[model samples]
Target: MPVDSCHFRTKPIHRNTLNPMWNEHFQFTVHFEEMCFLRFAVVENNSSQTTAQRTLPLKALKPGYRHVQLRTQHNESLEVSSLFIYSHRTEEGPAGGATASSLVRFIQVCCF
Candidate 1:
């Protein structure tokens, strides 16, 4: 799967396996989660031909491990497992403290 114009990519898993374990960690610096989306593609490793692709909204996702049922271009169903974690850093003052008002103002300025 790729996100944000191919800026992030997960390691490929083996083909024809009932259960594949990637055990990989991917980190992304997300500024606008509302506008961000995830693109999944199932491509042939050797031929490089895309067999299936799907786009999903980021904000609609929930945290923790889950199963994603994807649809191919031909509208066939495919199941995949995934884990999602979302985190953001809060801006701190010179004294290294973040106030509630400051965080609210930051969200208003950025999200609105």
Candidate 2:
């Protein structure tokens, strides 16, 4: 799965509780929505390894809020670990008032 401007990171919650929230927002331009996977990862500060992660296939996503279940690096599900997010897809024609043959699509994601 290929994505444009795909890499994004959120600020750490810094709290000691099991349920942490960042309320981060991110956007990405995807060329092919059917062949792309939206991947989310949690990493500690100054560490390259991911603490937990989840991947969602764009083709299966519905426009609305969703609770995405997360898993450990070894692909084991973590109880009560998930992401609450809202995602929507928008389509636009070519820039500069050009023809509509080439449409651009953007996926806007908001996490809370």
| Model 1 C-alpha lDDT per residue in residues 2-94, reported as the tens digit of each score | 333434445666763455554444444444556767665656666878776666676665554445555677767656633233323333333
RMSD of each: 8.2, 2.9
* Tens-place lDDT digits, model 2, residues 1-112: 4435478878767785477777878888877666788788888776778888987788787888999888998889988898899988888877676444466678888988
Flag regions of model 2 displaced more than 4 Å: 1-5, 95-101
| Displacement of the residue 70 alpha carbon in candidate 2, Å | 0.2
Top model number, TM-score: 2
Residue 48's lDDT within candidate 2 is 73
Q: What's model 1's TM-score?
A: 0.57
TM-score of each: 0.57, 0.80
Q: What is the C-alpha local distance difference test score of candidate 2?
A: 0.79
